[model samples]
Target chain A: MEFDKGLIGGSTVLLILSLLEETDRYGYEIIRELESRSDRAFQLKEGTLYPILHKLENDGYVESYKAKGERGRDRKYYKITRNGKRQLAKEKEQWEKFSMSVNKVIGGELYATD
Target chain B: MPLTKVDKFLEDVLSHIKFPFVKDDISFELESHILEKIDYYMEQGYDSEKAEELSIRDMGDAKEIGILLNKQHNPFLGWLLKITNGMMIFFIILNIYFAGIPFISSLFSKNPINTIPKEDIVYKIDINDDKIKKIQITLNNGETFTETEFYEDLFLFAWEVDNEEQGRYFNNIKGYDSNNNVIFQDEY
Candidate 1:
């Protein structure tokens, strides 16, 4: 299926904020988490992920610093900011409301009453 | 084959990206991720070439991705970016030129030269109907006046006087031309 660029771009930041809610993660770790958690349904490409990460950093939604990895390679680690957490909560509420309405339409859960 | 294919794919992708950003740490990270994807494909029994092709295909359009990356970090894109930054520098230089027009305009106006520091220079103006026939000017120091006159719709005249106490010469001038220009100066 072709991906909608606009939807993917906007949602990528929200997805980042949501993932950082669980714990601090590096770039690869976050991508891996999204893949596993979505049951391999959302296959995010590498090129897509880094740009969103950079944008979030530029927007002050996240911050990064260099840290030594398990294999001794220096890796950039990102952590959510207070602002990021607040934004995540707001986005989560909106997503829930949106998905609920969408499910009603697509999931056949909504019916007309006589 | 996966490595070879991956290398070619990266070259294509990186070429779409302008210099500097393509070689940044972020670029390295993305490159490693693509290699990892190639490795995963290879694990699934695909040859190196197939694995690399699959990985590149999964990555989608690199040009589109590069544009997104540029938009994120470049800060200067779009028309507003060019106008504020590129044209802003041009506009600042233009402002200096625009600022001089009024100063030049004031030199020709009928108003007395209010900008000059008054020391010991005295200025006089005589008007008859629409024509200015003469202008009298005096300096406190022992010096004389020099005059220049030109004809226009009205006669234009100007003179300069030297002051002793101020130890500087002052230009006390007047014009009768509709279009004003400083036609007279006296150093004596």
Candidate 2:
């Protein structure tokens, strides 16, 4: 079943940024990476993928450059920036807290810390 | 077909995008994705044709994808472009408003100047009581009536209305009482 897009949409940025932090990757490479890692759960559209890349580039979160690929052809690759790492860390911390709260609520141990 | 799957996909995405400069990047990236997917499917022992078909099918709906892409690409740039378009439209209207009226008004109200000199004029006025204020008059064949300077007793004006030639000239005009009111007007 398709994951609720609303739930997944916000995480896409975090995921892309975190992955790029691992290594510089091309568009298709990132798609393959995300898919394989998520076990085909997050099927991303290429059309949906590009604007995010462009936005990250625009925001200085990531940058793209052309380099010769293994096929001896030029391919565009995106690398995460210092700012992206900072943002990714912030998002991860927020997600951990959010997920912990969600897990507690689901496990019937919903408790609030004052 | 020029309507090849890749071509159609690019058309769908680019149509929603407002920025032209970014089109090349989008085209190259998306085209590369489809090509990569085709390569992957072919690696799994599929024929080239089937690989291409699967790759295209895997891309999902172009319109929906375009909408999502637009949602990301257009926030700042779209609002910026819209404001630019709005300002351009506003300035065009403003230019027409400020510049157009006088030009159009001039076209219709293009009256030939009155060649009559100041010296060769005589207006006889018969009045003794009220002072003359400003006189509004239209010369014979003039397009519009306008105010002329005539402080009575110091200056004089005569309105000559011609029936055959279509009407009025203020050559010799006159008269005012103490309070700049019309004292006498004798039209000849």
Residue A103, model 1: Cα distance from true site in angstroms: 4.4
Worst 10 residues of 1 chain B by lDDT: B150-159
Task: State the lDDT of candidate 2 residue by residue for B1-188, as single tens digits.
Answer: 13286787778877877656566777777888888888899999998878878887887777876666666667587679778999999999998889988788767454322233545443433344334444433344553333344342323333434464554554333344456565544433
**Candidate 1, which CAPRI tier?**
acceptable
Docking verdict class for candidate 2: acceptable
> Tens digits of per-residue lDDT for model 1 on B1-188?
32666666566666655435334665666666676667787899998778778877877677767777776656344345656886888887787679866676656664444444565234334344344334333343444343434232223223444445575343343333334443333332
- As for candidate 2, its interface RMSD to one decimal place is 2.0
After the best TM-score superposition of candidate 1, give how far the Cα of residue B114 lies from its true spot, in angstroms.
53
**Per-residue CA lDDT of candidate 1, range A1-114, in tens?**
445657665567778898997788887778788778767656767667877887788778899887867756566788999989888888878776776776777755553110
TM-score per candidate, chains pooled: 0.52, 0.58
Instruction: For each candidate, report what fraction of the true interface contacts it reproduces.
Output: 0.44, 0.53
For each predicted model, how many residue pairs clash, with residues at least 3 apart or on different chains? 2, 18
Global Cα RMSD, each model: 13.6, 17.1
**What is the fnat of candidate 1?**
0.44
